[model samples]
Structure formats: structure tokens, C-alpha cells
Target: MSLVVRPSPAIWVDGEPATALPIPDRGLDFGDGLFETLLVRQGQPVLLDYHLQRLQHGIEALAFPDCLPRARDHLASACKQLIGTPWAALRLTVTRGAGPRGYAPPERVVPRTIITSAPLQQDRDELSAPITLGWAEVAWSIQPRLAGIKHLNRLEQVLAANEARALGVDEVVMLDARGLVCSVSAANLFLVEDGRLLTPSLEYVGIAGTRRRLVIEQLAPALNIEVVQRDVHAAQLEQAAELFCCNAIRGLQPVSRLGEQHWQDHPVCSALHAGYREAVAC
Candidate 1:
């Protein structure tokens, strides 16, 4: 794939406006980085702390130098430019800066932080609409060490998203190497069964989404809904009483159809979505 660089006014590198990253940058060359995509509401990044916490975990796991403070400051500066905008998408990326021509790390590392912002395209009505999901042909490889963090190595998600597009579904349910359901291409999956809410365990694969955590720890609990983390099989989708997917940007989206099975009028999902909107409202 040829790399196409487009100039954007919303890009910030090391707390300054810039259009391009240096050649040989580790993020570009080897995907040696971590990123967080946050929903910007009223010019502020929602769930900022959760995103940062995940990034910190990724940094520690990757043995990268501490750069969260710098990344945070850059993100704040970038967000300030979106003050009048009602909604936007913010991405904060941290990479082990340009290095010599090998996998060996430089004795001293200076991580690069890039912050970018774009207007959020999905409207409230669009986000509240029910969507369809298909099974992904691409299976997630089990990598426990990198399981829960949002690292830049997303080729698996990229492929799954392409498959979803081809299949004419809003998203695709990805399975781990063992054929256990993990998550959707870009969100966390939740299954409602027997009046209990269940989500796939991220111990072996998938990103531990901030929205997923919020739903499990706050929204569901507030409504007295039981939330369980376990190995959910693909077959369970057919039997689920209700199904939903969530991410920081889109909040909670109920699934209307998955293959031949169909769902309607998800009361639990509706309540949870209302709770999420209330929690994140500016």
C-alpha cells in the first residue's frame, strides 16, 4: 500500500503544529507505539483518565520511556483549538522516536507525541441506530502480553473491518485463535442472556475498551444488571436476548441482527445507552 500524506490543520507534534512525521519514525516503520482515540465533547476529551491509564499500561508493557505527562499536555493544547466545536474525535499517539536502522532501541529514547483532531462525523441519531454484525474470517492471535492495550499494531482489526465492509455489516465479531468470541472490529461486544450481561474476557485478546469498563462497572451496576467476563462462544450470539457493542467514540450501539438471528426493542441496552450519554454529557 502506498502511503498518502494529507495535510491537516489539526495535527500537533510535540505540542506544535506540523503536517508530517520524520522518516524512519518507529510508529510508521514498525508500529512501535500506542494510541488512544477519545470523544471530544464541548472541546474536552471524554474519559481522558481511562485513555491515559490504558496508554500508560501499554508504555510499561512495551518498555517505552514514560511519556504520559507530555502526551497529556499536548492533547490538552490540541483540544483547546476545538473549543467551539460541539463534537470531535481526538487521537493521541506516542511512539519511540526515530532510531537507528535496526530493532535495537537507542540507549536514550525520546518518545514522540502526536495529537490530531477531526470533527466527529456520526450524529446522535446515527449513533442510536441499531446495526448488524457479521462473523469475521480473520481470527485474533492470542497475545496475552499485548491483549488489553491499544497498541499501534492493528493489522488484524484493519483486515476484519475490510471483511465487515465486504459483508455489508456495521461491524464483525472477531474470534480469538481458539474460536472464542473476543470483540467487534472496533468496539467491545456484550451479550445479554438470562437477564445477565456478559462480555468476552480480554485476558487473551482484544482491547479492553474504556466504554466497556464504564458499562460493566457503572452503567450496568446502576441498573442492577449483572456483568460477567467470560469466554463467550460465537453460537451464543444466536441465543442472546440482546446484543450491543461499545467504544469511547460511539458510546453504546445495540445490535439488531447477527446472521439469521434478529433482536428488537432492547430495554437493557436502551437504559445503558441513556446512562452513558448522561455520564459523558458536557
Candidate 2:
């Protein structure tokens, strides 16, 4: 049997529930869109400003500058609609709206925005548990133009996620085409080495995750650790004292193994995780 995919349940669109975009939409045709996955706390988005900034930055990168108006108010209001859930995962998506055939967009553009919210599952608490990981045979593409934006083109991650499942690892550390460590399938990769926090630079590959940004600037200082951005390789993974992955929803998760490597809970990883939680909870 083959697997079937379904669109996410729509929560709001152009001020209507269950609304869907037209077929010729650019986002559907060419991945001409950007999105943010947010964690809702007590019906409010955490790190909301950062999420919007990233989304706006992504929009501008895609040549739709100022295509999105102030989205914070609309996003917060959408979250309020899910107040009964208390904790939810909200996905906000923006497409270059609709247009006629051909790569060239219409002289005028009208952007389409979609927001969906669902109750965050309890199993996500397992993120605190140190999980297994492995390297993916699939490598991320080096697209400098598209680098660092949470754009709609995610075929790489989808492949990486499948590789992780087939390899029976909780996550996969993806490499760039140059074999430099970029990120895990679903989140940003971080390793603690010699008392400093290190993660891959998103200069040429990978998305600049909102939580990763927070960790580099805010979480590291709170944990009293120096953070560095540079190319990391599998060889460097062996030198890491502790390992973790982070995202807006899971916040941060410790890694115990990547292939043959094994790690125990370290003070630095624990401290950083606590700091991450405090930052998100606040």
C-alpha cells in the first residue's frame, strides 16, 4: 500500500475558517512561500516577535518585500481561538498569493496567509529524554539564495526524515553537499565541546531556526557558555562532549548516540536545557 498525504486542517485564512487557496497558487506550484511553526503557551505564542521576524525576513528574501503586513496581531488572535487547548502548535504560512500560468508572477500580487492550530501532544514531553541519532546519506543542497529562510521548499528535510526512520534513529544529522554538518532532520544541531556551545553556520545551508538564534545569543549567555558558529563535520561530532537538538516546539533535546557514539547526561547540556525552558516558558 502507498501512503497518502493530507493537507493540514485549516484554522483561519483570509479571515475564514476551513478556507483553501486556489489551485494555481504560487506556493503550491513553486514553493514560493514561507512558514513558521510556533509553540503556544496558555494560548499565546512564545517568542512571537522572533518568529515574525524570521517569517518577514523569509518573505523579503523571496522578493515579496513588505508583502506581509503586521502579522503579530492576526497571529495572536488566531492563537486566542485555540485557548481551550492551552498548549498548541500553530503553523503560520504565507504564499505569494495566486497568479496565472508561467514563472513570472502577475504584475500585482496578493499574498495568501494560512494559520492552523492543533493541541500539542503529550508525547512531545519525551523530547527531554536523550534520543538516538544518525547521519543521513542524503545531503542538504547549498542554495545561498535560499539559505536560512524557513521557505516552503522542504524536500530535503522530508528525505532526511525518511532516512532517519529507515535507519531507526530518533533523528538524523544532515550534512551539506560539501559534507559539512548542517542540521538534524527536524531541528537545529548543537554540540557542547570544551565548555563552549557550537552549531553549524547557516551561511550557505540550513534554516536559521528561531530557537537556534535564541540559544546562540540568549540561552548560551544564560548558561554561561560561549557559542560559536562554523562548519562542523562528522569528525568533530566525535570530539563533542555533549549533544542536543533544538526547535521552537521541542525547545531542546539531548542526544545520546549518533551511530556508534554514546553520551551521558552532562551538566552543560542539562543547564542549557533548563535555560532554554526558562526562556520559552517566560
Candidate 3:
């Protein structure tokens, strides 16, 4: 995994026309940053407001900056450059900015915002059957203070994903230190049992994914389903009627296999996928 953004792809840093960063930047030094990956369709980003709001909340929570207005302008400018492309993936990263060579941050903070857009492959399959998932032996740590923040420190995910790949699984389910279902290596989890929606409460760990929030706040109500956010243990998922993973970039991933368990065409998954697409269209 190279950190280099390709020259072919459009990239901008802090409204500047460049692709490099300072070596001493806190983002590179300490993983002190936030990022949002958004899906751009036919030039326009879907649910742009939702994505921006999450990043804004994170920026404020991290006490980084009030850079949303300029960030939005930069994003708009980047999107405009790709307006004719069929599809693109946009990534926006904001770091606490460069600082002195110590743990103490600068008294005055200047955030560094990086925006990148790259054309998406035109022929990926989104309608394929549900993907296979496996349980990762590595457990995620419980950091309630950073829960749902989407911070840049993702070594845990990198290790988990590597293990899943080595095991020939498309994705891995991660458990928190307390043996509760946290999420997939890169996305949030949702389970359906007896026509109800269930997901782990991010109060303890895991990110509050953009798509996950939208599903709870909009799609679930539109589909007339009861949504529950509470502690989810690994044993609790054993008999689930349906399971799916979600994030902004990969909208929805229906789970077809987890160890010996299997399922197909779960009505709730289909309904929610339909509702989710429609909701994003608005």
C-alpha cells in the first residue's frame, strides 16, 4: 500500500495544487488526522452533506480547526474537475498540521487538508451475491474516547485485513476486547433477526460509518423496521437470519458465509438496500 496519490489522479492540499506533505506533519508523525472516503457518481458526490457533517464533527471533537468551509470549497473544486467522469472516489484528509519535534502540539494550530479524486473502475460488480466473511483472531481495543471518530490510526485494521486475506476470506469480523461484536475490518455491522435490525453500539468501539448512520436514521424508518443499538456478542450473531456490512465507499455488503453459517436473499437486506439507494438519491 503506497501513500503516494498518483499523478494521473487529481489532488489538492490545503487548496494548493500539489500532492506532497511535510515530513514533520503530525498526520504523518502520529496518525493524528481524520479522513472521509466518499462515492462520486456521475461527477456529483452522493450524500455530500452527510459525509461533510461527519468530518466536521470529528474535526471539532479532535479540536483541530474550523476548516470545513474551506474544505468544502476545495472539495467542490476537486469534484468540478471530475464532473464528466462516470464515477470517482474522493478522499479528504485533515491533519492537525505540522508541529515541533515533540509530543506537545503547537499553541496555534493550522490544519492541513488534502483532497484527492480518482476515476473509478467502470466495470466492478455491485450486484454480485453476498461476500464470504471470516472471524479474525485479532481483537480490536476498546477506546471509548475515540469511538466513532474515524481517526487515521488503523494499524489494527491493516493487520486484521492481512490475516483475512491470508485465510482467503473476503472480510473479517472483529470483536472488541470484551468479546462484543465491534465491526468488520473496514465497515460497520448490521444483523437482522425476526424482522428487526440490530447493530453494536459504538459507545465502546468501532467507527460510526456514514452508511451505517444513514441506515439507522433514514432507511430503517422508511422500511418500517425496529432498529436496536446495544451490546452485541459474538454468540449473538451465530443464529442471525441475515448479516451485512456497510461503509460510504462500499455501500452494502451482504454476508453469505461466516464459518459454517450461510444465508441468501434475506428480504430485509433487499428492502434495506433498495431503501438505502433511494434515500441516497435524495
Candidate 4:
């Protein structure tokens, strides 16, 4: 697929076009919110159900009001505006509305939804291209309370991405404070060893990505690959036969280099890449 030039994103707040959010919005004040970045194809969100399911989990975990109906309505309206666009990136944000001057949330809560859409500047070939990774010096804090939800506080990722840019690598592998492999700066990490797929458990850190779930629950089973979720050590990557990172936006990206270790295009990675494309097409 060819990409379009970047354009100013269309913005909507609570189902209506808007320019700015209300002051004291908790999303901006305290990073108190959840957001989903999705791919839009021909005016419809790809893997919308998966995105909504994750969002629902976040809503429940955060104890926010029921926002799925409103979120769906807003998303439908936003998709209508992109009816002819071949590809676009959509971001849906849900916040606990504006709150008083402290961390303590009000007893009666109201949620706010913000949606934005912009032309997606992506080349199809780039998605499968192998890339290099560097180990980040910063480590993830183990916070089970915020482990798998895609909340708004992303300072850790920001710092790690900066480290990657300084190292001149595509991405950086992040480990938890306990010195166990977790994930990359912006995606989920996976390894292929002994003809089986291995991914780290997210009980203490890392976000459980929608694409990761798809791979474990559907794609890997279709290929008869045994999926294993357990604590992975940084040393394991050196012994793995293959390495790849995945997320909703980019799908699957194979890692070619990490320090002295390097990898070529492995068959397992290739099959999964092809399967991801087919899955998205449907």
C-alpha cells in the first residue's frame, strides 16, 4: 500500500468537532486516561472489536463510567468523515473528565472521550523490514496495578525511545527493575526458540497488545505453534532462533540486530507476517 502525505488530524471531543479540551481534564492533568491507536482502512477500523475489548477492560479497571456505547458512537461518526481515505490512523482517548485539585477522584465520575484521525504515512514493505534494536539503560518499574492497561502515563517509554534514538537503532529492548526482559519501547517482544514461540508474561510490567493476543490466540494456533508465556531473561534473546516485536499499529516487525547478535529472515517470522496481512485483509 502506498502512503499519503501527512495532514492535520481531524479532532472530535465527545462526538463533536472541537479544538481544545476543557481545563483541568484529568487526562492532561494527571495522565489519568487510556488511549488506543488503531489503523483505519476504507473508513472502518481494522480489529475494532479487539480495540474495544481492550478499552472495555481499561474502563473496568479504572472504574470509569460505561463509555463503550459513547466511544462506539464517536468512532462511527469519525469513520464517516474518512469514507474515501485509503489509510488513516485513529486515536481514541478516554479520561475521567475534569477533577478537583488533587489526586483523589470525585465520588461522582464522568468520563470524556477524544478521537483524532490523520492520514497514515506508512509503506507496506516497511512493515516487514528487519530492524535493529538496542538495550535501553532505563528499566521499567514493576507496577502490577498498571501492568497491562494502556494508560496515559508514558514517561518510561518516552525515555526509552530517546535512548533508542541516541543509540541510532529502530527500537530498544526494555527490562524490568528485576532484570527480566519485558518488551520494547513501543511494542510487545517475542522470541522463537526450539520451534516454539515465547513471549514474556505481563503480570508485573508491559502492555498486553491486541496484536499479541491475536498471535497467541489465533495465528499461532492456526500454524500449530506452541505459544508460551513466561518470565524471559535478557540472556534468552541471545539463544533464540528468531526475534520479532508486534503491536496494533505496525503488526509484526522482525529484529535483525541486537549488539553482536543478528538474524536473517526466518520462516516462522515470514509465515506470521503473511498471516498477519491476510488476517488484516479480512
- For candidate 1, the TM-score is 0.95
Q: What TM-score does candidate 4 reach?
A: 0.96
**Deviation (Å) of 264 in candidate 1:** 1.5
lDDT of each: 0.90, 0.83, 0.84, 0.89
- lDDT (Cα, tens digit) per residue for candidate 1, span 87-120: 8888899999999988887898899998888886
Candidates by lDDT, descending order:
1, 4, 3, 2
Cα displacement (Å) at residue 244, model 2: 0.4
For residues 77-120, write the lDDT of model 3, one tens digit per residue. 88888777777889988898899988678999888889888887
Clashing pairs in 3: none
Q: Model 4 Cα displacement at 281 (Å)?
A: 1.2
Order of quality (TM-score) = 4, 1, 3, 2
In model 2, which residue pairs have backbone atoms overlapping below 3 Å? none
TM-score, model 2 to reference: 0.93
Give the alpha carbon lDDT tens digit for every residue of 1-282 in model 2. 767554354488755676666677899999888999998877768888888888878978888847556456667678877766657889988888888988887889888877887776543433477889988989999999989999999998999999999999999999999999999988999988888888999989999998899888887887578999998987888679988898888878888898788998766767776667666666
True lDDT of residue 261, candidate 2: 83
What TM-score would each prediction reach against the true structure?
Answer: 0.95, 0.93, 0.93, 0.96
lDDT of 4 by residue, 1-282 (tens): 767566689999998999889888999999999999888877878889899998888898888889889998999999999888878889999999988999988888788999999877564424568889999999999999888889999999999999999999999999999999999999999999999999999999989898899899988998999999999999999789999999877889899999899998667878887778877775
- lDDT over C-alpha atoms for residue 34 of model 3: 92
